[model samples]
Target: MGYFVPVEPGVNLFVEDINQEGSKTIVFIHGWPLSHKQFEYQFNILPALGYRCIGIDWRGFGKSDKPISGYTYNRLADDIRMIVSTLQLDNFSLVGHSTGGAIAIRYMSRYSGYGVSKLVLIDAAAPTGFTKETAKDLLKETLNDRPKMMQGITDTFFFQYITSSFSDWFFQMGLEAAGWSTAAIIKLLRDEKLDADLPKIDKPTLIIHGIHDKVIPFAQAQELDQKIRNSQLVPFQYSGHGPFWEERDKVNQLLTQFI
Candidate 1:
């Protein structure tokens, strides 16, 4: 079922909940400039295996409310907290990709990993995101020619060959987000520090990262594995930044085994 859940006053987040009665539950948080739609493949497959999959679109992205503020990591993490509390979710697996992974990190630290049992970070942008100079250029590009910037992101998204239609669809997802939200997230990627948040995660973590990822380096995954106690690192050799899509079957297998 798909519905909007109010995270705060006048701000409702779009949530896609599948197999509501399944025994296991997994909450998926998407990357920057994208929404819950990023996990379409997972939703299609995971729910069939008796696992409930919940995908949430962050505010200002996807079908969620696009507010001008609340772009900070703390605010984003709080938004997630409200969702978990409202749904009464407990002992669920939390899967986050890219920026979503960073947000998950903040959630683990800020909320003490409330209802989460296991954590999965896919090519997560943690420990650090981007340098000041790169962030400045990205923000400027987003402001000036957002489409071009998104297209560039799509080009480097996957190492394997993706059809033109698939590429267009992925590119469109990025464009669906608000410009301010996109730029603000870029700033967050540059300034937000998750060094302190790493060691605080006590849940078993599965760090899946692409060896050829250009967006967030593979080293970041190594750092995360090292910092987070009781964590395992699984490298996706044939994928890039988007291992969920590039190596979907392997990712699904890993998730199945881990969860």
Candidate 2:
């Protein structure tokens, strides 16, 4: 796919360019600890449905130039803006998940791109009073032993995503998916708070959350649904934070409707 979009100096905004001639653009933003790779199902499936899907890898993740700094929501938002402007994209949609959702919201609140028309939050992350309090305490225990912490997060971060096929392969996969320092990851945990910016959003919004989401929980999704004025919440009966990953067919179907 010719993925090329630089967010800023020293911060490479990673992108998976699906089409240049498609009618409308649907940019996919990935979550913390995951890069554009997370949108594999959508990137490959949605284009068949006549939607241009471009998944972006934030500076510290994916194929982008991962500098030591520039992992905050503000910096990440700037990276997204750069991708949009650099590509000259218009009348587009943004599907962001987890931390990526927070990044999209930051972009919407700050920079309304030339043609960004719709926004979808797939278990999207928002401040709405959600905190990385869990991460904070967890970080303390694992700061001195990242590999041990990474081992512990194998399931918590990915659910029953563990397996013999991937086996220990998925271990490092989780670690480098979105390259970030402990401080940066902790910073993202804190950035999930969006109370000050949700009301300012002006685009049509779709909030999809799994009923069984243990990572972000359903209440946060409910709070997001209640807060976003033009937003609608779609409950996935059996899934977690990465419903799109767990249920691509369903997620793509709803995305088709939403976009």
Q: Which candidate achieves the best lDDT against the true structure?
A: 1
**Least lDDT summed over 10 consecutive residues: which range in candidate 2?**
174-183
lDDT of 1 by residue, 1-259 (tens): 9999998899999999999999999999999989999999898899999999999999999999999999988999999999999999999999999999999999999999999999999999998998899898889999999999999899988999999999999999999999999999999999989999998999999999999999999999999999999999999999999999999999999999999
| Count of clashes in candidate 1 | 0
lDDT of 1: 0.95
Error of 1 at 126 (Å): 0.5
Candidate 1: misplaced stretches above 4 Å?
Answer: none
Which residue ranges in model 2 land beyond 4 Å of their true spot? Answer: 128-133, 157-162, 166-170, 177-179
Candidate 2 C-alpha lDDT tens digits along 59-165: 76667776788766777788778777788877899888987888888888878533679989877767642356766765664466666666665566444364755
Positional deviation of residue 166's Cα in model 2 after best superposition, in angstroms: 5.1
